[model samples]
Target: MGSRITSPEDAAARTAPPMRSQITAPVAKMALSSRIVGRGDASFDGAVNIRVETSGLTTPPIVTGKVPAVGSMITEGKALLEITGRPVIGLAGVLPMYRTLTPGSKGPDVLQLEQTLDRLGLDPGTVDDEYDTDTSRAVERLYEKAGYDAPEPDGRLTQAVDAAKAQVDTARNRLRQARAQLDAAKDANVRDTSVQQGAVDDAEENLVDAQEADGEAKFKASTPLPVSEIAYVKTLPRRVDEVKVERGGTVDGVVMSASGASLVVTLKVDAQTAQRLKAGMAATLDLGEGTPIAAKVRRITKNGNQYDVVVAPNRLTPSQLALLRDANVRVTIPVRSTSGKVLAVPVAALSSGSDGGSRVEVLRNGEADLVPVIVGLSADGFAQVAPKGNAELSEGEQVVVGR
Candidate 1:
């Protein structure tokens, strides 16, 4: 047998067993957080049916034109329809216009009308319960924008006002004539001046009566808001769901039905998840179109063990609204999240340190080094980590996830 000479490297290679593959992963930059997902259906909120019925018309109110189309968005001060050659304007208010608003009309409904006018930038002077000339002017502007004239006080009232003015003039003329007769009697040194003075007194009394009648008639003839000319809706910018009346149809009850313009997703989740959600919290909605839509928490209601979560989506395009309307969607809300990108590692790589703190085994020069770390949010099988004390960890550094 011959003796074999071997170098140190060869001897070491022969003594060492076949190397086994080690399982390791690199540190990554990512956001870590826990998320709550729930299935929900999209729907519109605050639905309302619109009705425009006119009274006191000699002829039936035929919808001549300007009928709003279904799916159209009706905003404040917008015309809903043209009835009897006049526009029926829509205004936002909770109170229905039950009666014609005249100069003396005073109530909560009047205040609502004034406020709606102010919101529309029509400047209804002061918003108050009493309807005044400013409100009437605002109403006129509203009608003007709709390409029509505002409803005026009845012609009969106007004629009465004119008649009252004529009476006032006649009474004044009679008082002047009575005074002239009294002066003539004084000039003639008449013994019985009582008759002339009595005539003057009677004329004065008649004049007072005439003045009172004139004031009353003028007040009755001020600009008036006819209930038939306006429609009150609880919400503005409402989506027209259905149009019950056509152009040539007669104006009747329930001309249209509408709802809130924006769409919301309603979801039911467990109490635990519901507790983590809050109104105005950011969320994402998946419509199964590969693109997620932005949304926010609108409200939450509890019923027994289940809670209802309402999520309001950001402004969606018309096409997007069409796609989401009455469709099932996935809602994801993150209760906790990292502020931004941070150092992270697989949850499997984390282990209990000697002092019960968290630690990761970093591979350096074929040796394992225990680096103490503070664990942050853990999500998706990963945890945000920060090295403790003088220990250092960085991205792309290999960490032992498993043997």
Candidate 2:
């Protein structure tokens, strides 16, 4: 039978422990003795208690083979408590495990492997960073090159799984060699002096030329051709001639605004080339004829090729306009013309020397004497040389490019 509560206090007493319940306690003292050893400095500590608890009620002592000698009583006590509650107990030494896998001993990275395979002339097809059939084929070829008994480059790699280990060593060596070359090129001071010097000079010259030509070409290409107003006149005797412009009548599109009938030759030249050319510059116009017509450049347009320049006849008259119309002409644009005595060499006979200078392998005393010459302006495949005392070099002298 359950007891019924008459008051709230009675209900609380029934729900919890009864307040009237009391007991007498024992007064005997017990001491605990503990020693922390097996470390650098041995230590001891004792604690006393006045409880009448049973001997079996004490917590089990923690035993350890080695304890690091650190902080005094505070740290030692905390470490002891933690070590007892640990789920695992073992020695302080590391476990013996073979370090077979290193920083790079895993399977090859697909991207780099694909690049290397391509470099070795083995097409891995796609560089998608996947170890697909193509990658396996490339690996097999690599193994074969490494002197391993691997299967063909068809992705059948099961039989040579162990032998394929050799491929890693071979590929690593190749990677080292490539890295060495890159390092050497990067460190200018350590690079081959002759090669670096020549490469730097040539690169600088090429870059300057490319930039100049690019800017000139863009500026010239964008400028519109010049338009001019013309007054057309019918031909008559000079004293009785009259010039007139009709309201709608047009002469067959006079290409040139200059007087008289002559052809206009529009030539495109870079700023550098234009510096050498000017109005009244004599040029030979070859209108696909075996013989060329001698013409004087009568006008120089502000924009070369983007605008046309009228070339007047130094000889012919209006009779030549029929010959000039619709005629495709190739003008002989001369860079330079030299006739006076100058130390000259045939262009074909010139070759770059090992010491980074231009040379002409001239036949001297029946033996090839490679003469390093500083060449000047070249015209028609003949370059003028300076320090001119090479009287031995003549117009028809044979020079060699190589022995």
Candidate 3:
């Protein structure tokens, strides 16, 4: 039956604009988008600027070899370069290798070394600070594995050398006693006696034995390498950032630069933002031209009012890393994120109701129905919401965005 608008109010209501218009498009019945995002400005310092320096050495060392390839990521327990013909192993540590370490040496440096070796599968016996025999053996194995020779003051050979010296001392004592007896007989005017003559002969033979023993003891193989010859770092598995010297070049201090195992992206933040950062927190790195790379918070350092946070990439191919080095890039971090996708609508479509609760004018079958919804986070002009009552709303349903 055709109905007529009997009153002006009815006519005005019927003739008024269909609260909103709808257009058909080849789109989804249900769509999801980000509800919250965090943005920040990041000045790319490029890849780590590495100027390889010689691990502390007292004297200038000649670079006998450049063991690691340039731009190579040096993993844990590896050498960065050969200093004075010996590889200066790079380990992760804050303390510098101060003194020359030998067998029986005890200190923080030895513990650092043993820990690095053990982590690399070298098994330096116990991880104690003492550079004992086991540590020496492990160090040798490490050197051999790296295709280099272990430095001197090695724990393995020191004991053998000490024992040899002790034998020489005993031989010398025997020779001294025999010589004293011969001298006494000669002084007593027994020059005509065969016994005195025999004593003299025995003394001469003992002296010869002692001399030979001393010569053999001193000739025993020993390492003249000083503790200073080895370079120590605090951590392991670092990447070779730069190579400063080539083979035959003098390592007068600088050798090469290396970064820790994880490539870090350093950024500064205000106190408010710094509070949000934590180790292992996730972030996004945008280099402007390419897709954003994923990263995690590695560390944060606070110095006075300035706070610096370090970030690391979850994974990056060699080519990707090559392209990113020193490249000016931007990074974005999401301060808050939802566990999963949620229903969201334009904030403009939301309006107040008599009860002061939030509601959206939903369009259904050419009619306007107001449905109450609970509001959550609002970002990018969209607010996360859920049906407040029995009112039903589904994804892709038409809702009035504006008057």
Most accurate candidate by lDDT: 1
Please, what is the TM-score per model?
A: 0.73, 0.32, 0.60
Over 126-184, each residue of candidate 3 has an lDDT whose tens digit, in order, gives: 89988776776887787778777776544545665677567667666766776677678
Query: Which ranges of candidate 3 are over 4 A from the true structure?
Result: 1-59, 67-70, 75-79, 92-94, 120-127, 152-225, 244-254, 261-313, 328-343, 353-356, 362-370, 390-398
C-alpha lDDT values of all predictions? 0.88, 0.40, 0.65
Better TM-score candidate (2, 3): 3
Which candidate number maximizes TM-score? 1
Q: What would the TM-score be for candidate 1 when compared with the true structure?
A: 0.73
Q: Which stretches of candidate 2 lie above 4 Å from their native place?
A: 1-263, 304-310, 317-319, 340-343, 352-357, 386-392
Tens digit per residue, CA lDDT, model 2, 1-403:
2455278887777799545521212111122111111101101111111011112112432322123222212110111111122211111111211121111122333454455557666676776555455555654564455443332221222223323434444445555555555557778566455655555555555555555544443322221101111011221111111212122222222211112222355545445455555677666665554456676655555673443333444554444444554455566545454555566655676778787878776664656666677776665545665422463444444566332
Q: In candidate 1, residue 35 scores what lDDT?
A: 91
Query: Predicted candidate 2: what Cα RMSD to the true structure?
Result: 59.6
Error (Å) of candidate 1 at residue 263 is: 5.0
Q: How big is the positional error of residue 375 in model 2, measured in Å on the Cα after superposition? A: 2.1
Residue 121 miss distance in model 1 (angstroms)? 4.8
